[model samples]
Target: MLAVSRSVTRARIAARLPIVERTTAGRPTPTRTTKERTMPQHPKGSVLEFDLRGTGSGVLQEVAIAGSEHAVRAEGHPAFGGTDSAPSPLDLVLSAYVSCNQVTATIVALGQGITLGAFEGRVQAELDNSVLVFGAEGDGTFQRLTLTVDLETELDDAAFDAFVAEVARRCPLTQLFERAGVEITNAWTNRALARV
Candidate 1:
């Protein structure tokens, strides 16, 4: 019995394990630890919870986050029997993606002691709505996504590329979309920062 228990423990230790860490936004992320370990170690991290409340009526939906007074509204297109008063769900998602990238970039720049100015981003996505409209037997996710970012900074081309790579690697939304099998294309343009 002691030998069997030791063998099981050794096998478990040889397997790859995930280490959960917290991001600056208080979100938990699973990352790969060392390749080999001697013993199992537990993480002493606190979990953060985010709650959202939403109300929908006639193709119009309003959502509010917990502990926040601000709310956002979304509506379907007029062709979909909606009043078209607000942006569609996909539009909101794209907006969030773009903003999240910018936010991540800012955080990375601050950590690296880099200065930035006049940042802008544009995103386009190709999606098939047949699954939602006709209940087709296919995925309803975006087929392809392209994001272009324009930043005014003093960093050289090589440094700019490295910075963008780091931002993409650290951005949670980018990770989520890529893991979901979305084909993403990102282009970054750097310009000289204006001197005051």
Candidate 2:
């Protein structure tokens, strides 16, 4: 049942966007017509800035925001010559993407007068290690990413679709990946909200 939902979501996304062709490096190269090449608009004074500081040596770092009581420890993977202590930079990036989507979804649901239950997200990425590890001539970004989200909601099929679409449009992290030319697919599963 979940697999069928994912298939439908993928089909919907593919049908709405312009056709994309795969490059020799297995990355997607999107093709758009003149009519479809409009840029997104940002209203005045809408920009938000964030700042953080980190200190580390030998592929391990402790990062924290100013005036915050919490700090995050990050380390490089063992393959990159660092002790496998904490999440690597790439892992943090994927974590940001998932958390950003959930936050955006909560805001969207609130605005739409909807209530949400338990939510979970998973991200799978294909990284081209050749560029990072070896002196490769290609881009080092993830070749592809798949984000699957499971949410318990009471909305119907059409409402769920609209909610998901709106969340995608408003998610800053999603915009970052799309603008960077990363091939990303989002599969959302809307489960029935359990009543207690």
Candidate 3:
């Protein structure tokens, strides 16, 4: 230990000592200054949640939806009747297929660096039943969707056809809906234990 007297104790040091500073042969020590990896935190997540209620059917659920500009649901069905005038699940689904086609077309156009002036899709869904009755099985269903696209970006016919081809390939719900397979598994709940 070095000698320390009463004078050294009373004298104030000119500089503070660094904690365990190492001085290797010639290379300087590495330091992390202002390079810390920090990611920005989102203040809030998405603000959409559809409230689903049981429609008391085999595989049907009533969704009380929001995010519409208006304030009343289209039909006043007690289950799907929201404060706003929007369509029901089936209606929304029909519209979703049409809307999805439009969106997919836009994405396809952007990927190919083309510009679409106007795009509109019209869809008609038929139950094919003689009459509308509650829980009546369909005779056979048929649907037709017509899409009209206007071009202002001056793309050729082949390019436009390619865009439509991509839309037909991609659009999701319709392309996979017919060919999709589903598996249902039955499980008992806590309350079902009593009955069992």
Candidate 4:
């Protein structure tokens, strides 16, 4: 297991960012991590922080978390879009895939002593009934997310393919999807029912 880094500080906090405010009351808001690990989702009122350190290959849309709107602002750069307010959950999912691949690639390449240059990943997912139904066939409720990735790297084809598989194995999103066998947790206050 890689010694993952949890090195974010309050100084690294984008206090003005709306998403930061959404993290108020200790809620984990949605965002990517520095090495690009998308932390598991938390219940409402949590802070989700991601440290983005991807090379400016211009794949991701530039966004900013400025001044307490309680969510990250989609500053959408010229490549993706411009001046959009925020990214939808779907958009974030795609980002999560990208980040996951990047992190996975880094660890896999370094471990194998492979020189990696220009890593890029594109993910395509479908929000349809088939995948969901497949996952929910039994007495479990589940959501299905599938990604088709196009990876560009410098390693040999065989090594790169292995690297991709390795990364996918360790990628947080893939792990959650593969290991999460739908078991919903529902809790609520008990109330007395009056006899009528």
By TM-score, is 2 or 3 better?
2
lDDT of 2 by residue, 62-128 (tens): 9986445668888987789877889998889999999999978876776567778878999999988
Q: Write the per-residue lDDT of candidate 1 for residues 91-192, one digit (tens) a residue.
A: 889999999998788767776777787788999999887987888998888989999999888799999999999999989889989998999999899988
- The lDDT ranking, best first, is 2, 1, 4, 3
Each model's TM-score?
Answer: 0.74, 0.75, 0.44, 0.42
Clashing pairs in 1: none
What does candidate 3 score on TM?
0.44
Residue 6 in model 1: lDDT: 23
lDDT tens digits by residue: candidate 4, 1-196: 2222234323343343444223537775544455645454544223454443222223333444344223433333333443345564356766876677677656566556654444435555444434433554433423445454444444456665566677767677777656765221211111222222
Q: Over 4 Å off in model 3, which ranges?
A: 1-86, 130-143, 148-152, 177-196
Residue 37 displacement in candidate 1 (angstroms): 24
Candidate 2 accuracy as lDDT: 0.78
Candidate 1 — worst ten consecutive residues by lDDT sum? 1-10
**Whole-model Cα lDDT per candidate?**
0.76, 0.78, 0.43, 0.47
- Return the top candidate by lDDT: 2
TM-score of 4: 0.42
Tell me the alpha-carbon RMSD of every candidate.
14.1, 13.3, 27.4, 18.6
Residue 162 lDDT in candidate 4: 66
Which run of 10 residues does model 3 get worst, by summed lDDT? Answer: 187-196
lDDT for model 4, please: 0.47
Scored by TM-score, the top model is: 2
When summed lDDT is taken over every stretch of 10 residues in candidate 2, the lowest stretch is 1-10
